[model samples]
Target: MDSSPDMGLFGPESVTWKVHSEPIVTMGGLRSLYLQALHPRAVAAIAQNSGYKSDPWGRFNRTSEYVGTVLYGSTDEVERIASRIRRMHSRMTATDPRTGERFRIDEPELLRWVHVAEVESFLSTARRAGLKLTDAEVDTYYTEQLKAAELVGLDPATVPGTAAEVAAYYERMRPQLGITREAAETALFLTVPPLPDFWGNRALRLSLNFGPARWAYFGVAGTAVALLPPWARKMYGGLGLPTTDLSADLSVRGMRLLLAGLLAAAPEQYKMAPMRRAALERAGLA
Candidate 1:
């Protein structure tokens, strides 16, 4: 685990690469954030430690890049980024609103919570968006991501490394989770953040910031929330009905199809993260 080969942690042949190289996974990331925020202290840690309110997309981009680098970056790059995160988390702390007790951000339970949430969200969201992944493949993806948990200082054995383990982990954790005011506010902000300007294109930014675009972003956010588990959605005061799930499934599938088409025609630079781009370039696919 200390050194990665040319293909990095999970190479092109891996289910990790296959699942992550999809447009729908952006919504998956959003879903993970929503799920993570369900834990009061986890959201509090995020709210207090990061400038997500002032720079949401920047925070998101960094998270996305970290995942990308772990999946596709070389050995040194992965180790370097992981070390930086461990160092940063080692210094930051957050308080529990319920007990008024302060805690380090990188506590083992908190780290495990975040990791399982991301893995579940990413895998489930991909399946809902119509990825033809099998149950065994789901287990494979989970097993492969064990290294990701390790990178952040968790013992792989302590983290869920299979679908059943993840389900059991959530069951054990649900009673400890609750909706705090911070979690609600974070969800609201994520649903309605302003559109970001594109590559200094003022005109394009202005053009894209219209009512429809805002509502469209809201739609995507809502769909991501919809993919949350029934209990989790109910805690958010959302209707956890079958119809809502059906509607979200249709919306995600449609969006994924549309985005796949658009991405297929997009320039190479526009369609991937730098780490992924570099990997593709090495494979002569870029």
Candidate 2:
């Protein structure tokens, strides 16, 4: 385990290091995808290039691995993955249905949109799901994530790094965002993803049986939607508004407890990503 200060992009003392280590933060990934899909061009690109509907689990796993690498991998590993993504994005192109104009996936605006939506989703979900952190800590988390944005070709200085900046970014970008057909389909796919016949072992298969899986998935999806900003929810036609904040709070709290319990019960080796495990060992936390 490398304990050197410059090994990883972010050290243990960073708010991003702490926030991302929590098991509960995994819940935000879908919410971030849903929010990112709201942008017409972004959804168009995904619909055209990604096998999200056909191989949802594969897409999810890939996303999880990418995020984990960024959060916990050594500096060289981080740059390697980031460069791969950047090269991939540069070669991909999507045409605007409305204007018939083709645009590269690595366009600055699209990169910024994706970056902001994802980091905001992660921070918001962690806070709402009962991962305790102060307002200043939240700000620090946002600031630290600019490195991630830069990895994907976004200008770190231009990206939002505070709650206020995020809000303003959303407001400014609102005019360009709306529910496209692709986005609606994406929302549906996320809410009721098709599970594979066999995942891992019998225990996993039983848990993912259609009836139980649909019910459990809807519950988690509903909570994720509920945790979105009101404006974002409205854009999705009020998909997950609880009757009251009390209900929303209770739902999120229950999810937090459930995830915490699962993490505690699972084997330590299974609970953490390989890079994360190594980083923790290096920091003397494993």
Candidate 3:
């Protein structure tokens, strides 16, 4: 029942993937992937594609480019591009930064996270560019996606049954969502936002590399923003961070920074806290 994964981003005993009653949620869904194993895999992907050294910005750009090709390209084109990512991931054998244990690139956990991330990326980016959905609509979409997740071999217990339950689940898992938000903001401030035109009209395109974690985050965040008290929504809107518009066509890097900024500015509003710590600890973050 303790489905935590070690996520040693900083170092062993430094970072870990946290778990919750529901899976890690995001405004766009790929955030979960960026936080866990996909972080490394994404680095690997960029390294392979461009032979570029994997710094934060390089890795972030590669992620954005990969997403663009897969999501925005024609189905045939996306499949071809995705094949490269698949091949890259296949050749990778990574050590857990915490435990130094090696893992196959295509392990179920990794694959599931990747799948979710891609779905989330597709949906969130689509929304950002001009797609629309209602709370009920998203809930329905989530319900169907859960079925798809299960069919694709996502563990049944890992799926959330309702939107509120997803929020409550994240709250239970990390309790550090707010603190992580602070860290996320700090990270963002240190990095430049991806240029606005970098994505261009490509936002309308769907990619296979979309991370599920980003999608879940987008969905949860969107739902949270909409369902907030009118005063809160107005406040957030005044800040120019409306959930409805936050995830649109945002580069993966932009999305990360935007989310971080929101959390850092109003950690209380998002209930950021130690939940990620527990989840990461379970994953071997500690």
Candidate 4:
């Protein structure tokens, strides 16, 4: 038995597709992680249940695959993947660090937080990276992502479905969020993921450890932190002045141009994410 949609939840015309296609969107993924970690129960659920400390890249790879699948897989495949996530989270539990209250990871509130953070990060990062979406298109992107919220058991009405709503939602959620010890550790882990051991070669690992590759990845991480809302940055103890947003926008533009040149120069060699690449081929735009 097999299930594959000739098309996924979105297509070439979608703002979702446009934003997700940019090579620099991975920076937004990192940004979303930091934003999500600001929630106490959200990060607590992650800290108690995730193998991120032991296998950060593996965790990152799985997350990337899930996002790609959700955005590009057929309708049935989307249901399959979402169901698997629902079941896994349903069984996990985390204790609130502040209240000592135990809560299920799949609670609707937590799922909504994660979804909103991803949406905001991806859209904002894409724009900052020079995607040029109009104000109406930004609202459309948010509305389109309601499909994503539904797949995860959230009531679409409860999730933000416009740029204005997203801003309001963040304002409401602000009172509930703050820095936690777990969030600080997660931030450190993200900035410096366990790399060389995962790559596995004596001399090659050393090259990676002290190499331009490591520093370059860190550079992206720095940019991701800069993309966070100013208040979120303050909660993380702040990294820059008011001009940091302007500098980060410039950095993203340069990074996007560099990546585009690299991809064009070596189209056959560049390893785009598998599901993303397949979706592009399916849409006849690869």
Counted clashes in each candidate structure: 0, 0, 60, 0
C-alpha lDDT of candidate 1 relative to the true structure: 0.88
Clashing pairs in 4: none
> For candidate 4, what is the TM-score?
0.93
Sort the candidates on lDDT, descending order. Answer: 4, 1, 2, 3
Over 35-153, each residue of candidate 2 has an lDDT whose tens digit, in order, gives 99889998888888888777878888888889888988888889999999988888999987567799887888888998888888888877777888998998888899998999998
Comparing 2 with 3 on lDDT, the higher-scoring candidate is 2
1-286: candidate 1 lDDT, tens digit per residue: 7343376687777899889887688899899999999999999999999998888888878888888889888778899999999999999998998899999999999999999999889889989999999889999999999999999999999999889999999999999998999999888888877566453487766766675776788889989999999889999999889998999999999999999899889997787777788987766667
Off by over 4 Å in 2: 1-6, 200-209, 239-245
Q: Give lDDT for model 3.
A: 0.41
Candidate 2 residue 167 C-alpha distance from true site, Å: 0.9
Best by lDDT: 4
What's the ranking of the predictions by TM-score, best on top? 4, 1, 2, 3
lDDT tens per residue, model 4, 149-254: 9888889988999999999999999999998999999899889876737577788877787789889989899999988999998898886577989989999999
